[model samples]
Target chain A: MKNSWLALLLFVPYIALAIDTDKAFEDPEMQARYEEITAEVRCLKCQNQSIKDSNAFLASDLRREIRRLLEEGKSNDEIYDFLVARYGEFALYRPRMSGKTLVLWIAPALLLLLGGGVIVNIIRRRMNMPIEDDLQEPTNT
Target chain B: MSRFLLPLAAFVILIPIFMVGLTKDPSELPSPFIDELAPDFTLPSLKDPEKTVSSSDYAGQYALVNVWATWCVGCRQEHEFLMELSRSQSVPIYGINWRDGRSEALRWLQALGDPYVASGFDQDGRVGIDWGVYGAPETFLVNADGIVLHKHLGPLDATAWERDFVPKIGGGS
Candidate 1:
């Protein structure tokens, strides 16, 4: 069909955003921090995608907001606090240390101790076995 | 026999945990503003852009703040219920017309019944961002002290109104 060119216009918005996301941050370190922060924060509506990776309108809004905060000289911790204060801990890809999350944070150590206890119990039971039992021939008589 | 029993016990425990998770809507985020002061804002009124509405205007009164938009399908689905609820006069409802055209919102409200006492025109959605509004049709129940008591993330229906808002208000559904 000769009219297929009109279908390509649908991609204009994506092209616009491609140019927008590449606009540089003033300081290189700040840019690195910006990239890390965006990658770390979850897009609330699009739960699986980080803000850096999402094309959702809400994600774009968040990216703009995060940049504004960065420009205002807010630290990454302060930005996290700001997001968590409004959106709750769900926005954080990595949860903070808190009473509610204590079990999650300590689970690995608990599992390690449990595994060690099982191993020690098995070794203790084996320690009493005779080492010379197989050395002698069987007496059929 | 002991090894089989240990895993059986773990399986029994996991059943209840998984069942509880099944009933929850994973898309719903836990409301962080519950028992906290409702975030403050003053935006142009949706009905008349020249006049502004502020969160403080609803202070000293129990109110419902609804986030909506002409572009949101959920908002359209919930509009009829909102109109009916407005007729009942149980509580005053405020609105945030988020990231939507002021003209289109006004036209929609005019064509449909106006449920919100004062709707804020959140043209750029900055106020919505401040309120942690990730989705449209989120509702907040605020007490007379201006503390946000509950947040309903999806469209309001009779079931949620009875289950969530009624218990908080201590009223018979």
Candidate 2:
């Protein structure tokens, strides 16, 4: 009885993990599509969690919808466009490049360039100042 | 002085942007369906499962489509206010009884009061997804042409109706 209880205790976590697994898809291609789409779609109820990771009802509904769309032979872009049309761009984990999101995509590179320029400018100024100091040192000597 | 001024200006400019980001609720995402034609769906009536209700029933009239569930605590909180709104008859209210047991929903309406013209039973929440409902207790205002005017998340109160809804409906509150 004690050995059986220990075995059950060890098996409990695997059961919990299985709960989040997607429903069985008959086609392997459809299963792959399901995995890819769920990973990219954010659970709107839990903004931080992907639909695959979330247990929210909305997430499950979205997963089922994705499966249904895939079965209907809709392309990935069409699926994404459908979700974005209803939930807005926020539904996508990787936002598309558009007029509104142009800044978001460009800002990181712009800031890095600006920072690098500042560092190079400071180093050049330091190098030039040291040359002037070296020249004055000879005079003192 | 010039060196300090550049960073100072950057800091000053960033403060307001950060403040706006901090004040805004990240959970309250903007729905893209606003001003777009409301998605058409045919769902069974909660009371009579055999009969169905569709979006076309509310054509040529401003209507409120309220997504609710018996299990959602927020729905209970807003039920009284919905009842009051139904009594006023300012706009016809339609309910999407989303992902709920039929018997529980029917009993809930009986115990509180039926506020909807017809409550659609969304057994699997397919229609709720079409409406872009992330959570329960989302209310959408549909114009006469079946265009979604606005979507309000969370429990609605008198203040929310006055501020977010009244002006859109052209009724001064």
Candidate 3:
């Protein structure tokens, strides 16, 4: 009961946006897929804004088109493929993993590895160095 | 030697990382619409009766074409900047009013002072669509040849005026 209530509370803000997708609720799977797809694609004319955030005519047209395609029972992959073919990769904010975009994909991972390597090198050097106490000893002699 | 090397490497690496973060995204270049021939349109004047304005009117002089709407808060915010810009510059400033009413737009101009040489009313937003206007508060700096020299998206603030606009156009303080 608590989990369901928590889910409802979490979804309250999104509930308003849900009204715009009236046709998507025909099937649970399709609704989920519709949300997933719209969340990725951006509104072309709007400045760095997603289609979901934009109230522009183009955004609305894209939304209507997505709904029409969904009603036609097109699979998520098929819809994405169609859009990618038509608009090119610029349509997506979170761009697809591809050979052309490999640098963008690997950048964060590369930075992490570089940072880890530096930390490991520092640790190794610190471990290998003799302690100041040891170097200054022979006080017993 | 190891201690010195570690700190030196860290210092070098840290500078480049900070530099990378400061670098603007090159792929998302500033307004690719610049230097192209200004898109043509004739729109009604919100203030006057049956008066229409077009791009051809500003054929031989550098003009600052500002896109604004009475409904936009940013437009109101930049009103003073426009006033200041008009006073300081020799170039004529024209306005394209997007998705607004005549009375409301006139009221805004009355309350804030009109900085435009002439303003065009894009009542249905079709004119805006033709000019590639995605939203209000976009400005285009057009050269004497009717070619756009620069396009500034979003609001024109003090920093933009001082750092970008003034130097490029040779305008005032």
Per-chain TM-score (chain B), model 2: 0.96
Candidate 3: RMSD to truth: 8.3
Task: Output the number of the DockQ-best candidate.
Answer: 2
lDDT of 1: 0.89
TM-score of chain A of 2: 0.81
What docking grade does candidate 2 earn? medium
| Residue-wise C-alpha lDDT for candidate 3, range B1-173, written one tens digit per residue | 66599779889999998898788653342443466677788988767759988998888878889999988887988889899878876678999988788899998899889999889988766666456565568888887788777777778878886775556566421
Specify the highest-lDDT model's number: 2
**Model 1 clash pairs?**
none
Against the true structure, what is every candidate's RMSD?
A: 5.4, 3.5, 8.3
Task: Looking at model 3 chain B, report the run of 10 residues with the lowest lDDT sum.
Answer: B24-33
- DockQ for candidate 2, C-alpha atoms: 0.79
Candidate 2 per-residue lDDT, tens place, A1-141, comes to 999998888766653554356667898888888889999999999999899889988898898899889989999999999898888889999989999789989999999999999999999998877454444345554
As a TM-score, model 2 comes out at 0.90
What TM-score would chain B receive for each of the candidates shown? 0.95, 0.96, 0.79
Candidate lDDT scores, in order, read 0.89, 0.90, 0.76
Residue-wise C-alpha lDDT for candidate 1, range A14-125, written one tens digit per residue = 6344512656697999999999999999999989999999988888888888899999999999999999998988898997989877787899999999999989988998
Q: Could you give candidate 3's per-residue lDDT for residues A1-141 as a string of tens digits? A: 999998889866753544254454767887887788887777767747677777776566666667778889888777776555444466778768998678989999999999999889889989998766566555886
TM-score-based ranking:
2, 1, 3
